[model samples]
Target chain A: MSSSSSGNVGIVIVSHSSKIAEGAADMVRQMVGNAVPLAWTGGDTDGGLGTNVAGILEAIEAAWSTAGVAILVDLGGAETNSEMAVEMLAEDRRARVVVCNAPVVEGAVIAATESSGGSSLAAVKRSAEEFYA
Target chain B: MHNVNASRAANAFAPLTASAVLVNAVGLHARPSVKLTQCAKGFAAKIEFALAPDGPWTDAKSPVKVMRVKAPQGATLHFRVAGPDGKAALAAVLALVHDGFGEA
Candidate 1:
């Protein structure tokens, strides 16, 4: 976790397939800005049926350095992958990382774009609450 | 068909807030439309969607109401739910749209 205060909101959405991940991420970028960083994993690139942790880790590092990081993942193995990522982070870094359960792929971007001036965690949480409640 | 214009219907709920994207390549056409309507049926919130004049506000739970709205591909719909769990319900609708009716 780099200590830079970019105040930039970063979101990474993981899916079993890169297409799904890219689609959701692109949809969000369309709503927000074209510069949102995305870390795509899984599918043929990783040659697996689930998300690739290495790719996700790289994304996390990028997001953390730019601003805070929010993660949205598809259910099932994707969820497990996100959880594992959170566990791997240091205590302080873990605080900056939020694994959102909202319709994530869609919700995270909506929340991130909508947040504007709040912490990345707040935006992701809002998206999750909206999805949950 | 059932007295949508009735005063009682007007009094049935209040305004709510939510966001959703149009799923289904055809976008708000058939089966999924019914699914959305069905999901909203049990709620008393007065759901309304906003897009363009072509896509006017409609009840979230009514198949007929949704059918009349004509939300198309990639259209983003903002909903106001003015009843119980209205916010939550609206979020769900947003998810459905974002998911492209789970087709994505």
Candidate 2:
């Protein structure tokens, strides 16, 4: 979604650990009640990690097709992995990849839940950046 | 105590050994698992866990394995360390769990 209109914002949070990822997601779910799209990549290398590059891309395309806005959060290894994945994408898709500045748990949950008003990926990242600042 | 952060807790892998303490507290399930995994980040080691008192230990860094032990409040879990800096990491995490995260 563009910044000028009421578009959906997809939010991602990466934590240094899987528990933090799930905790962050749980916090947001408690706050926002599942209205927002959430994805997590914790520090685990298991198959249950859910959203990786393929999953993230699929989420992005889904958001773009459905909501036209995508926001991603990567904590710890998730950050490096997600970034690497984004780098492998085309310019158009890569443009949508925005890493957040918020702490893995609190900041991420807060920013993602509060995201509205046609928030852009940059805006979400800005919120995350300011979250840490 | 030092504030726990993502970067500082990385790659500090440890192993799951015998535990004499059970993590006690309400709703205190996943937080420790998360902490353990996060603490394992950035270090050049691996982390795994096992239930204390005759439970099998699994990958400490794995959220699923950590949760499987279900080290609920008042439940003791064991930890082991087998990599670089494993001793220090094990000490730190064990202390955290032993203290019930300062809530016990």
The DockQ leader among the candidates is: 1
lDDT of 2 by residue, B63-84 (tens): 3345456666655566555566
**Candidate with the greatest lDDT versus the true structure:** 1
Q: Each model's TM-score, in the order given? A: 0.51, 0.44
Clash tally, candidates in order = 7, 37
C-alpha lDDT of residue B18 in model 2: 43
- Residues B1-104 of candidate 1: C-alpha lDDT, one tens digit per residue: 23355345545656545566675688886445545654565455666676753334675654444655677887777776666566777777777677776664
**lDDT, residue B93, candidate 2:** 67
Candidate 2, DockQ score (0 to 1): 0.02
What is the C-alpha local distance difference test score of candidate 1? 0.62
Docking band of candidate 1: incorrect
CA displacement after TM-score superposition, residue B13 of candidate 2 (Å): 60
